[model samples]
Target: MRSPQGVCLFSLNFPPEPTGIAPYAGALADGLSKAGFSVTAHVAHPHYPEWIIADDYGQWTRTEERGRTSVRRRLHYVPRTPRGYRRLLSELTFGLRLIFDNWRYPAAIVSITPSLFATALVALRLRLTPNRPPLIIWVQDLYGVGLAEVGEGSSLVQRIVRWIESSTFRAADHVVVIHERFNALVTQELGVAADRVSVIRNWTHLADPPNTTAVQARRQLGWPADVILAVHTGNMGAKQGLENIVDAARLAEARNSSVHFVLVGDGGERKHLESLANGVSHISFVDPLDDHDYHLALSAADVLVVNEKPGVASMAVPSKLTSYFNAQRPIVAATDRAGITAEEIFAADAGLVVPAGDPEALLSAIQSLCADEQAAERYGKNGRQYRDAVLGEPAALAKWSDLIQQKFRDSNQN
Candidate 1:
């Protein structure tokens, strides 16, 4: 392995992906370039939430952009199935296309994944290239757990996928996990060498504070002044356990019909969730907001809530929690605190924590926060201060620059 004068990032998601990692990869690419390493982002056509390719990228093979850094778009199949099987095919198809697309622009391979279907391809690419730049596997979720949770395939299929996942982890020059719990999962469950793993929290998506008053923002968004609004914005997947929110909403509506529960995002389960909330006057759903509007919409919330299914604790460090923390709003986290979700809110003293999937607990915490306005404001302000000091742009950018540089040096040493 040898270092390049530049770093190339291979990520499936990019700018229009509308998820946490899209912006993160973009930021890293930009940061690496500004830190004196030329950067290229190899990304698939952006189609997220709805799982259909964006209308703007129609029939185009590739496009280059110079916003944060040089971005290279590649075409990949967008799965039309809800089953994880077709999704796996889509991921593999993208990886195959990426291999050919990146063939001439050889550099170190720093790939990310929840898709084990592509792990073997990436591992084989690195293994075959004797002078390959180090392959750093940036892990967000464990493929073994994720596959099982999503019901992607059968037991035998998962076993094979797990083998692929293990092979990639074993072959990778460095394995970076997002949290300490994940690092432990690698060492204890996957039997990875302790020295090969590193833990780094992904930064939040807090942009400039939206220049709108809470009242004005609420009015503009068609929200009422009397209701205590609880906002949930992110992926709508089974792992989110959003049903708990519906249950909590029912309980809250029973207590004070004025309280409103707002869901502001798209996901696999969103339509079903909407159906369940059909007759509930207090439940509201809105189309996904653009980045700027999203920030402003969050400002109107009295509390932010995040829910994770049981056993999904270490599998994912929910990226939305960072934005919630940075929004300076009290968080009602229905997730394990061991993950970054708990760490951010608890450390900042910004919100209350409850066990995952417990509607009653979520209801109680929401009630507690709503009941005490002064306490909620204090917690929210402290959270903003904590985010600025730790997870803000300057700190996040510096840390990302250092790690990419470290990867550059680590590759050279290898």
Candidate 2:
């Protein structure tokens, strides 16, 4: 049977790209496909974690099947700079590349953020097209606020970028954010109607259920059973406020607690973080693992971590929390209690929350959990239960299905 005229979904990150938004984007695509929309996913060539495009992909506009959807990769720039003009250029370059990614007039254009340029292109396409298919933006990060975090809001480039962001939000028929905080920003601050916004949290993308049963994953990874392993998985970027983890690691070692800090992922700040931990005995860094190993390792850890920079509460919600919930480990979120991450963790009764960027407070919280096995176990259980209740695949997919179909009146319209 032929797939119906469906949705054009564009995201900057997709499968084959490790960390960041890839897993979330890919999961959403599959969910939409399962909802009966023929999805054509437009993504730039994979270049994440290591920030180098693999030689084999995008040799000539490669196309591949991902369940019911088809993904098209276009060669786009991946700049080496950690920040500044070059990085912005890379984002814009990919956006420009997406302009030609063709599809039937999709009932709706759904874009996941960091796809700002591509999303703007969608707005422009709506302007050019006759039907003006509804543009739906799932904002994983509010670029305007995030750019301001990096001190880019005052720049001329940011001025133009914000204008485009406003246009994209204005063009969107519906706006999705993972947190209520963000919903408020998009509605009250950005002028999107409250009724048009939806808060849908992200979920783990692993296809397989937990499988490392009976094997001691910690022993396999050389972690001592006696030591309390506090593991943080996913991107090591500025927004993560991982410097606090480094400081907390130093404090843990100085106090000589059996608690050890393990960071299992890489990104722009990986090099600098390594430099900070050069002589630290209790802190270690591991490369990103395949899904099985990563999940098993996370499940084995005594504590899972979510850290965010000071004052980043309203700007972004760490999607890593969904993965953390899947890991079913007691969480230690060293962030503002009022922030989205802390709110979720607290509501789920999943973990302990400490003040953001406070080494002593983080150390105290880790030690508290390490001392009470029963409390930690309860927290872990709570997190797993919360994932089932809220962030599970069925719930997320159902929401997307309704939203996607809502963009069109009739099946034949698109």
* Top-scoring candidate (lDDT): 2
**Could you tally the backbone clashes for each prediction?**
0, 0
lDDT per residue (tens digit) for residues 1-414 in model 2: 223347787887888776778888888888788777788998878877766686687554878888898998888777654466666777777777777666566777788877777777767876786656677898988877777764544677767877777778877888888877888888877788888899887776665346553138776777667788888988887788789999988888888878788999887888899999989888899988877778777867888888888766666777678777776678999887887788889889999998888988887898888789899889988987888887778887788888777666543456
Best by TM-score: 2
With a 3 Å backbone cut-off (N, CA, C), the pairs that clash in candidate 2 are none
Give the residue spans of candidate 2 off by over 4 A. Answer: 1-4, 58-60, 149-161, 207-215, 410-414
TM-score of each prediction: 0.91, 0.92
Candidate 1 structure quality by residue, lDDT tens digits, 65-181:
756467788777786444566777888987886666654433456688755556558777767766677677888778786667556578998888777777779888778887787
Clashes of 2: 0
Q: How well does model 1 score by local distance difference test?
A: 0.75
Worst 10 residues of 2 by lDDT: 206-215
- The CA lDDT at 278 in model 2 is 88
